[model samples]
Target: MSSTQLFRVSGISLLLGALISLIAVLLSFFVNPSFTAPPATFQSPLWSTHYSLFFTALALTLIGLPALYVRQRGQRGDRLGFFGLLFIALGTFLALGMAGYFISVLPMVAAKAPQILKATLTETSFSIFPLGGTLFATIGTILLGIVVLRAKVFPSLVGILLLAWAVLNLLGFALQSGLLAMLVALLSTLASAVAYGWVGMILVQQAGVSGEAAYQPQTALR
Candidate 1:
């Protein structure tokens, strides 16, 4: 396929991935909580549904990364773009691992003990996975913001928002209050998604330009 075609596909994939991820985020907060909770234990259907959507988002996001990489490669600011991709990949992995551990493991622990084991596992998961994942994700998102700003592939507004989002995420980590942390995390995730989605859109447009340039006649008919 031509560069234009590739980018077109990339744009659609990126948008689709972002949409799925947004759904996953919502499901995590809403659907997931309903499952395997008190009075129900190991009988909630929401748990399985939540896990399914979470994994779906994970898979789609991972698949979208390669398309992004292909779009950025060979560009003028390729290095920064490539670095951005690296950061994003690392962040994605960390986030998924943390989320997976919480959704999969915590449920079982809560189901079995319901008191001591549940609380202990919850504390352990938050202290270890969330803390570490947030740190890694914050760094990655910040780097990605820098790359996007420097490359000017997307709107400057998106870049600025990404940087701000990264700062907010880092602050959330430091504060450690449930309400405050959740608020910041939500903002950061949404902002980062917008930035990345814009990048994908821009890449798609550039691909069309690239295709046109490639087909232009060299040395006209002198």
Candidate 2:
């Protein structure tokens, strides 16, 4: 109903999404013992967990992050924040498209005709977008983190965490073929969860306080 209420709802949604995504990532590890498994891996029960949870994560992020941005930017006319939100929205949409296709279409196709799994899987790699949705999201996160630091809306630590997460991811991607990259990638993944969780907690705290006082935009930092 109110701006504060919206932020609180967004925060809760983000937390739930982060939790689900973390579980999915964890379950994926136990499923095939490989970071990038073949289509056959999708036949396992964990497939349901992986696909459904990732899709849900992107969906929630699509809604939650934008709302969080709104609460932070408000009517101050922050251009950096606005662009950050736009990039996030675009990336999330692309990710949702990719995830939805994999979850809904790929499995069915793989089930009905196993022969085409190889071709289909290659055609539908998660990083289907030109620049890649993950990259877009990562860049957007970095931008948002910078905006947070400049605005001081949330704890600067949250911004630092986000920047660290993005840098880690970028490094991981660059050295993805190496053994050390795996470790770096793992750290990056965990950082992502933690970053979102921290932001969610901040939002929840702000919402909790909103009930006591009229929702003032500047009051969020307090």
Kindly list the per-residue Cα lDDT of model 2 for residues 94-157, writing each as its tens digit: 8777667666776676678878777665555644642476688788888888887887777778
Error of 1 at 139 (Å): 1.5
TM-score of each: 0.69, 0.81
Top candidate on TM-score is 2
Q: Pick the lDDT winner.
A: 2
**lDDT tens digits, residues 1-222, model 1?**
766777777776666666665665565454323222453533355655665565566556566666665754665556765666676666667667755755576567666766675456454545555566566656766665666566665667766877887788787667654555556656765775676677667766877787777667553533
Those runs of model 1 whose alpha carbons end farther than 4 Å from true positions after fitting are 1-6, 27-55, 74-77, 115-128, 174-177, 206-222
RMSD, candidate 2, Å: 5.0
User: What do the candidate models score in CA lDDT, each in turn?
Assistant: 0.62, 0.71
Per-prediction RMSD in angstroms? Answer: 4.9, 5.0
